[model samples]
Target chain A: MLEYVLSKYNFWTYAILLIIGLYAMVGKKNLVKKLIGMNIFQSAVILFYISIGVKKGGATVPIFLGDAHAAHGHEIIIDAAHYFIPLPHVLMLTAIVVSVATTGVALAVLILIYKRYKTLEMDEIMKIRQDTGA
Target chain B: MIWQLDVIFCLFVIICAIAAINVKDLLAAVIILGAYSFFMCILWTEMGAVDVAFTEASVGAGVGTVLFIAAVNKTKRRSKD
Candidate 1:
């Protein structure tokens, strides 16, 4: 039990974060709160992917630490044991930028919604739309 | 893994995230969320993801927070629930 718990503690931590974010996104009344919840959800996913790339006992950055010009075809072999996963890092980099962009767009939309309805509450907006037949 | 630092930082991240959502004030929530992002960046750095940490610091903690603050300024401060 101890070994199992120790080995999977990181996953448990992230799971808690995911649950918190999901609750905020699904249960919150404010539109901005939903946006913040989206941020948390994205961050949790990014962190999980990044953690998946980590290895035990031995790890190195994915970049070629040695001479590039003197490289040979025979030395192109990938030693998976020591090399870090550059793929997830690059993918998550793209994801982070995309998340920022999407958040900006979402916030802009929020501004428009607030301006039109004079409130940011989801229920209030829904009621307003119903009343206005919009 | 350095259990001490990792445990502490992870705990801080969780606390910040929870506080960010639970606080009634939207601006305070945004600030707390920014702090959460900073803690997450540091945690990623400790995990040896320097590039991810850099991106998180610049985009997530820096620009993202500023954008949130701007949105909050434009919207109502109090939440219905």
Candidate 2:
């Protein structure tokens, strides 16, 4: 049974990460905490794509002569190809950058909120908002 | 190396998520949300997404946890939970 379980480890891991990320994003009331959940959720998706590119018993995709067997029997093409697709890596590079930029912007917004309200508690802010009648 | 430990870690992530959602205190909820990110980092590693796992560990577990705490500090501790 354990052997069987190990065979599909990637899918199981993806499911576990995705669910945890979702719970954090949805179950929390704090806005910053919710953003943390959002980051986890995005990371889970990134992991999913990275897992899609894995190939058992295969080497990284690059245009090279490779081993003797490959050189003897395989034909070289200018367009690099391999057992696993490299598209996921390219896409994830963009995604990682974007996620970082988003985090920075979120922090900036949080700082602004703190300056404007002079308190970090959501309830206190709300209470003040009610008092000011603005 | 064996992968049994990975499966156990996956189970632990699920439990953490469930407990995070179930916890009554909003602060507790935020802290558990950080735990959720930590477990996700492990899951990404098990799946052979080492690059993604690194990014997630840093941003998700580190920056994300900090953001949540900041947001919590700005809000009421009392939640519907």
Candidate 3:
């Protein structure tokens, strides 16, 4: 059991991070802290995806470095084992961009919420809404 | 990729994540979150995801932190809870 847990420690770390992020999102009363949690959650997911592409024992980034014309003149054998899987990296790149955009939009909405409610606390915002009968 | 570096980066990332969420000051939390993103970037690079690490460094640590600080400046920095 100890060896099994130690072998895949990356996954375990990410799981802990995911749990922390989830707890912050659900348990935190501050609006910005919830956003921070959301960011952490997104990062953990990205890390998981990137980790999935990792290859052990002399694997490298997925970039074709050989000359295309030289390969055309002579048959060049490509070994899949030599390079890391790039699909997850590409996908995570897109995910990171989307996460940033989402953060920007969420922050804008948070600013508007603060402007309207005059406070960033969730309970205070709820009370203000209740008092105003909105 | 050195597993030792990976483990160190992971440890730092987790610490920063916890600190970011637990801090009462919004700006400080945002900055700690930036540090978390930086550690994550380093971990990605150590894992041989150079492009992803670059993107994370720029987008997650750079732009994200700036936006959060801007929002914090525009709003209140204190947290009751």
Candidate 4:
């Protein structure tokens, strides 16, 4: 039981963060809070994917390990066990870029909203929208 | 198993995350979010995710927080509950 708990505890940590982010997204009244929650959720997922690439003391980072036995004066990509998986890293590169872009755009839109509405509260914005019909 | 470091770092990350969301001041919340990202970035490094960690360290803590603060400055710094 101890072994099982030790091996799987990271999963539980990530799961708790997932729930926290979800709650922030659903329960927060401010749009920026929701955006921050989305970022937290994305980071949790990225961490989970990276954790999947780890092995039980079997792998190195995805790079050539040595010059003595490398064939064709080059290293070959082996199975998942001997090297950390690179696929998730590549995907997360794009995810990070997209997240930054989305945050920038959202912030810009938020500025525009605040300029017109003169308020940042979601409830206030919605009530004003109903009154103005625009 | 040396799970001790991971466990400690995980607890810190969780605390930072919770504090970031719960703080009433928007600026303080954004700054705490950056701290949370930094802690998570270090945790990712321990998990052998150098690239993801780099991205989080740069984008999540740096660019994301700046953008959030800029948005708050343009709007109201106070949140109505």
Top model by DockQ, which number? 3
Query: Between 2 and 4, whose DockQ is larger?
Result: 4
Sort by DockQ, best first: 3, 1, 4, 2
Per-residue lDDT tens digits for candidate 2, residues A1-134, read 98886887757766766776687667654555555556656766776787787665644432244576657766755433344556786688678768867876886786687778875556677899999996
All candidates: interface RMSD? 1.1, 4.5, 0.7, 1.3
* Candidate 3 structure quality by residue, lDDT tens digits, B12-78: 8899999999898888999999999999988888888999999999988999999999999999999
True lDDT of residue A36, candidate 3: 97
Judging by TM-score against the true structure, name the best candidate.
3
Tell me the docking grade of candidate 2.
acceptable
Instruction: Give lDDT tens digits, candidate 4, residues A16-103.
Output: 8888889888998887787778888888887788778777676767765656564566756557677788788889879888988998
Candidate 2's TM-score reads 0.60
Q: lDDT per prediction?
A: 0.88, 0.66, 0.92, 0.83
Better of 1 and 2 by TM-score: 1
Which runs in model 1 stand beyond 4 Å of their true positions?
Answer: A67-78
lDDT of 3: 0.92
Ranking according to lDDT, highest score first = 3, 1, 4, 2
Worst 10 residues of 2 chain A by lDDT: A57-66
Alpha-carbon deviation at B59 in model 2, angstroms? 6.3
- Tell me how far the alpha carbon of residue A96 in candidate 3 is from the true structure, in angstroms, after superposition: 0.3
Sort order, TM-score high to low = 3, 1, 4, 2
